[model samples]
Target: MRSLVEAQISRIKRCIGERLLTQELASQEGEGVIIANLLNRWNAFGKPVCVKNA
Candidate 1:
């Protein structure tokens, strides 16, 4: 999943190479919003943690 997200970000970066795409960037702002909404419906995703305990 991490690789998939990285690939998506890389694709976007390539598409906007040497230029900033405000409109495109705005459009993608909602990319993960839907998933977050669905997760909220299911009461998923607890508070985020920066590091894992070993």
Candidate 2:
């Protein structure tokens, strides 16, 4: 799931960096909601330990 998480993070950063350009991108992909939820949890309690597999 590392790749999945990384993909989500990349998408999120892209969305943030290019909000106007990617406004519809997230909605169309549907992973936006999942990313938001994950981000919220990460912000609240820091990233999960399991994600540091590198």
Candidate 3:
């Protein structure tokens, strides 16, 4: 579980980048929300769908 979380954080850093570009706590929080949403969208697209064939 811990590794999964760490991997996610690493992915975000790699895809978006590390460090907040905006100053102030409020903007930083907003940035976090935005990054989270982007990550969700990216993960949704990257997920593999398994189709069963008989």
Candidate 4:
């Protein structure tokens, strides 16, 4: 029973890791669209844009 519980936990961790990886990959691939959408939303909210020096 203990071993079975451990295996289920491991499977859940693996699934969560895979989902996070997919989200990261999708964000990287769609960065331009994401940035544009964010900017549009910011404008709609009347937020001031500030530049930060790296």
lDDT string, candidate 4, 1-54, tens digits? 999768756754564342333347677567646545754664477535899999
Model number with the top lDDT:
3
Candidate numbers sorted by lDDT from highest down: 3, 2, 4, 1
Off by over 4 Å in 4: 1-29, 47-54
The weakest ten consecutive residues by lDDT in model 4 span 14-23
Q: Is candidate 2 or candidate 4 better by lDDT?
A: 2
State in Å the error of residue 3, model 4: 65
Score residue 52 of candidate 1 by CA lDDT. Answer: 75
Please list the C-alpha lDDT of all candidates, in the order they appear. 0.56, 0.65, 0.88, 0.58
Candidate 3 at 53: error in angstroms? Answer: 20
lDDT of 3 by residue, 1-54 (tens): 999889988977887899989999999999999988987788888757899998
- Better candidate by TM-score, 1 or 3: 3
- Candidate 3: residue 39 Cα off by (Å): 0.1
**RMSD, candidate 4, Å:** 17.4
Candidate that would win on TM-score: 3
The deviation in Å at residue 37 for candidate 1 is 19
Estimate TM-scores for all models. 0.32, 0.32, 0.61, 0.32
Query: Per-residue error at 39 for model 1, in Å?
Result: 21
